[model samples]
Target: MYELSLIALIMPLIVGLLAGFIGSKINKSFTHWITTLGIFISFAISCWILIEVFLNPFLSFNQNIYEWMSIAGFKFLKRVF
Candidate 1:
């Protein structure tokens, strides 16, 4: 679930960065195709995740990707759900 969530979130960023970096060197059509494909895949993954969550309401998706800070017995974590 976390993997799917992260992929759905990061796929666009990765694809955009890649497309932008190679946009000038590659054919415009190729870049456009890749960007569109990336967006579609990300959207599909997101829809799947939503369906899974809806089907399993008791499923816990609390995942901590990073711990930002810890002070005075308090922890600040970056969570993805």
Candidate 2:
């Protein structure tokens, strides 16, 4: 089981952000298409994750992408489970 923690999760967010940035700079005609494409990709990834979970009975795979919060010596991982 492979967990999509680091690169996988951030890609869609980046795409959406890029779309918004470009949308504001350009005309309104292409804005909807770019936003729609980003949403579609995000939906597709979610579907794939659901499919992987459904196929595997013992799904305990997790990947720690980053340390989201740190207080003193404690480290919190942003994990995909």
* Per-residue error (Å), model 2, residue 25: 2.7
RMSD of 2: 4.6
lDDT for each residue of candidate 2 in 25-81, tens digit (9 for 90 to 100): 887768777767766776677778778879996877767889999999999999966
At residue 26, give the lDDT of candidate 2. Answer: 81
Cα lDDT for residue 67, candidate 2: 94
lDDT comparing candidate 2 with the true structure:
0.72
How accurate locally is residue 31 in candidate 2, as Cα lDDT from 0 to 100? 72
Weakest lDDT window of 10 consecutive positions for candidate 2: 1-10
State model 1's lDDT.
Answer: 0.93
Which candidate ranks first by lDDT, i.e. highest? 1
The whole-model lDDT of each prediction reads 0.93, 0.72
TM-score of each predicted structure versus truth: 0.79, 0.58
Q: What is the C-alpha RMSD of each candidate to the true structure, in Å?
A: 2.4, 4.6
